[model samples]
Target: MNGRRTIGFLLLIGLVLWGCSGVHPTSNAVWIAQPEFSEVDNRLYSARIAPQKGESPYFSFFLLTLTNKSSVDLVVDWNASQYLFNGKPQGVMVFEGIDPEAVKNAMVPLDTVAPGASFSLEIMPMRLIAWSPIKEKTAAARSISPGMLPIGENGILLALRHGNGHITIPLSVRISREGLP
Candidate 1:
């Protein structure tokens, strides 16, 4: 049953990955990321990607505005890649844990962003995911557990401290055709 489920999941991912082909060639390769919040319903916060009007084949970063709806303070540990294709989450990329230097360089501290407070996280182009052909060993790993591998055409994952357990976020991703770029 577990094997079946895994196969099913892989098939689903394949289908979504294949869906990219439906993307018209004339359709600008512009990225469209829409974040669907995981509803916990306790004074939830929100974030979104705002597409900028500009030239083609250009990288526009993920512009997120986090809104604090609850009265109490919500502490969001900063170590997750919140990228997804369309509304379906691609799965979280778990890094080697949060490094202060990485956070200092790549992320901005919320510093206890109070309730009803709003803060934005802007990920620039250079920081975004870049894709190239997978190496033989990495490709083999991807064939097994793409999630377990450190890097691939699928991009990077980050591990976040969630109580005792951890959550993963894909920091950067490159979805492409099976054979073509």
Candidate 2:
């Protein structure tokens, strides 16, 4: 069963790495990452990030669980939030059910979290999942090829708004690929 699932996953992820940031075209490649929320130290909010259930560990989409710790309602400004790769902005993040056209055109949505409340969802970088002027349409981790993304810091910088101010939450990620045949 596991072998069948892996084969299916590889067959589904037909994206060629090409010239992604960390990958070399003519070699065996493997993507490595470790995603967690413990490093984010902020007064306004806290968050946890992880891969989705039954998904590939090849750095595709994942779950984001954000908690509001402030006294005021916190807004997840999707328009302002960004995906970071190698410590740079890749693009805005997007969730399931979001219109691909909106992602292409940068039309994003915002979510509000009441004080002490939590907001949870699965998400990935729109640039990694949607059609764009600079990028062709790709699904899930198809664009995140091994060797394309250099082995370094990569993650999301969440934009949170509260009352008249805002705070940025950084969820750093590192992933690994081992035991694959």
- The weakest ten consecutive residues by lDDT in model 1 span 142-151
Give the clash count for model 1. Answer: 11
Q: After superposition, how far is residue 129 of candidate 2 from its true place, in Å?
A: 1.7
lDDT of 2 by residue, 83-158 (tens): 7877788878777556656666766667899999988987777665533433644664333222122345667788
Q: Which candidate wins on TM-score?
A: 2
For candidate 2, report its TM-score: 0.64
**Candidate 2 least-lDDT 10 residues:** 141-150
Best by lDDT: 2
**Candidate 2 vs. truth: CA RMSD?**
11.4
Clashes of each: 11, 11
Q: Per-model C-alpha lDDT, please?
A: 0.40, 0.66
TM-score of each: 0.35, 0.64
